[model samples]
Target: MKKLIVICLFLAGWHSLLAGSPRNIMLILGSADPAVLQDRMDVALRLYTKQHFDKIIVSGGCAAHGSSICEASFMKEVLLKSGVSSSMIYKEENSKTTVQNYVFSRRLKEADGTLVMKPGDTVYVVSNHWHAISVAARLRKYDNLEAKFYIEGSIDPKPTDKLDYVSIFNGEPDNDKFVLKGTWLTPQAAWQEGDSTHYLTGSLVYVTDPQNMRFSVYERRKVFSGLEPYAAGRDLRFIDAGSSWYVWNGEKLLHVEKQERKVRSILSLTDLIPGLSPAWKYSLKAGAIYGDRLLLFSDSTLLVGKRKGKIFEIEQETAASAYFRNWPYSWGRGNVSAARIDPQTRKLYLYRNQECLELNAGLKSVQAPQSLRLKWIDKSK
Candidate 1:
C-alpha cells in the first residue's frame, strides 16, 4: 500500500507540471517589413485558432523609415484580413525593441481598456528564430510574467522566401528605409550640497549611468560655499587606460582607463561592480549583486564574495556554459557583458552577444526552444 501511494503521488506531480505550462502566448515582430509582419501574423493567427489560448497580443512601435505606422498596426490589419475576430486581438504600439514588445504587450488593456493579469501570469512569446532566446530573457525579468519562446524560421534563407518580405507594405521601398544605427550613450553626473552639521558639508555626489557604457562624477555646493577640490575616495577613482596608475581627480573624458596589469580583455572589465575599483585581484567578466554576496564570473569559473573581501570559488567547468546559456541574443557577437539573478527562482540569467539561453539548476543544462510551427493556411482567393 505504501509503494502504491508513492506512485500515485508521483503521477499527480507530473500531471501538474504539464497542466501548469503557459497557454497564453505573445508573438513579437522584429521588423515593420509588411511581408515579414504578414507572414509572422499568419503563423500566430493559425496557432491561436488551434490552441486553447484566450487572447493574442501583437507588439511593435514606430518604423525606422520615419513613418507613423507601427508593427502592431500592420499585424492587426493582416490578422483582421485573415478572418480572426477583431475582438480577440490586442495591440501594443509603443514598444520599439523586442524586450519592450513582450514587456509592454503582456500588460495590455482588455476590450474594456482595463489592465489584465495582476502578476504571476504564464505567457508564451513568439518571434524570429534568431531572436527567440533574448526575447525570453527580457520577458523573464518581469516578476509578474513567466515566459516561454518559439522561433519563426531558420537562419538560412530559402529561395521561396521573399527578399523584401519584411518591408513590403511600408510607405517607402526597403532601400529607402532608414536602418537603426547601433550606438552607445555616455553616463551623466549630478551633485547636491551637503549639510554642514552632518560632517559632509562639502557636497554630495551622484553618478548616473543608465546604459552602463560610461561613468562620471559631479560636485555641487551652496551658492555661498566655495568649490572644494574633489579628493581621491574609495567610492570614486579614475583608472588610466594608458597606464595602471589611478587618477586622484576625475578625468574630463569618459573613457575606460587603460590598466598596465595584464588582463584578459575589455569583456573582463564589465563585471566590475559599482563602488568596486577595476583593479581588483580577481577580474570579473560577468556578475550580479545578490544581498551581501556578489556573484562573479571570469573565464570559465564562478566566484561569490562580499565587497572588499576574498572571493569563494564555486563550480568552474560549468560556469562558461551556464553564463553563455543565459545571455540575451540582442547583445550581438563578441562576449556577454550583462547578467541577472532571479531571486524567486534562484536562477541566473546571462546575455551574451545576441543569444539568450537559460541554465536549469536541477538538470544543469541549457535549452533554447524555437517558435512553434504554425499550420500554414492558404488564404489566396
Candidate 2:
C-alpha cells in the first residue's frame, strides 16, 4: 500500500505539468518582400480561425519602400477585412528589427499597449519555420527551460528534416545535455547607478549590499524586507547600457518613479514630458533622455524636445540615421545584449563578452576594446 501511494503521488505531479494551455500565445509575423506579405498573412489568418487565444499581437515595422503603413498596421487591416473584429487584434508598430518584434511583444504593460506579460506568465511563441530559432532564443535572458515554443506553417516539422533554423530552434544537445546560449551568457540586461549596480539574471536578483561593498546575489530570499517592488524594465533609467538600480517587491516587476526624496508610480507620460499634448501619441522609433531635453530618432532626424506643459514637444535638430544604422555593428551582429553608463564618468559601457568597450556620451568609442573574464551561471530556476 505504501509503494502504491508513492506511485500515485508521482503520477499526479506529472499530470499537472502536462495540463493547462499557456495563458498567452502570439503569432509573430515575418517580414519579407511585399510580394510575399499576402502568403504569410494567409497562414496567420488560418491559424486565427482555428485556435482560441487570449490576445493576438502583430509585430512589424515599415513595409519596404519607406511607407508610413507599418507591417503591424497592414496585418491589422487584413484581419479586419476578413471579418475579424478590430477589438481582437493588437498592433505593435514600434519594431524596426526582428529582435525588437519578439522582445517588445512579450513585455508586460498597464494600458494602451499590446499586452502586459508578468513574470510568471508563460508565453508560447509562434513563428514561421525559418525564423523560429532566432525568435525563440532572444525572447528571454536565461536558458528558457520554462517556456514552450512552436513553429507555424502549412505543414508540421519532421524530426529528420535538415533545416538550420529548425535544428537550432529544437535545441542542440552536447553528449546528454542541451547547450543554450543567450543574454545570460553575457551581462546584458541590467542597470548601474553610483557605487552599486543592480542586475536581474533569470529570476534571481543581484546587487551591492552597500553595507559591504561586495556584491550579493538574492536567491529566492526577500531582497528588500519591506520595501515595495518597482517595475523592472518599464520604470527604468539607464545609468549605462547594462546596469541600473530597480525597486523590487519580492515577486513581480514593480513600476515606480523617483525624484529627489519622493518616489511615485508613473501615472502618465506627462509626469516626465510635461509639455506633451494629451491627444498626441507618437510611435517612439528610437530615443534617449539628455538633460531637460529628449533626443528622439525618427524620419532620419534627431529631434530635441522638452517638457513644457500638458505634453512634451520635439523639433528636428539633425540627421538621426547614423545611430540606428550603426547599432548592429557597434553592439554585435545579434541583439543588443548588455550596455551600461557611468553617471559620474559620463561614459557608456557595452558588454560583448569577446571584448567589452567603453564609449563616450556621444556614442563614440573612447578607447580600444578590453577583454574581461566572464562567468556563466546555472539556469535551472
lDDT of each: 0.42, 0.46
| Candidate 1 segments whose C-alpha is farther than 4 A from its true place | 1-23, 65-68, 111-114, 157-381
- What is the per-residue lDDT of model 2 for residues 1-381, given as tens digits with 9 covering 90 to 100? 999999999999888865433445555554644534566677677766776655566766553234435577677788779987766666665454454455446542334332344444455455555565555554443334234456555645478665545344345343112221322233423445456655544345556544534656664224322222343333222212112122322222223232221233334444444554432223222333444445543222355566455344665355433442343232322222244546567665555433456667666766655544334444322
Write candidate 1's Cα lDDT for 186-268 as tens digits. Answer: 00111112211100111332233433243332333322122122333311222222222121222221222222223222322
Per-model tally of clashing residue pairs = 23, 31
Q: What is the lDDT of residue 189 in candidate 1?
A: 16
Could you tell me the TM-score of candidate 1? 0.35
Model 2 scores a C-alpha lDDT of 0.46
Measured on C-alpha atoms, candidate 1 has an lDDT of 0.42
What are the models' TM-scores? 0.35, 0.42
Model 1 per-residue lDDT at 250: 26
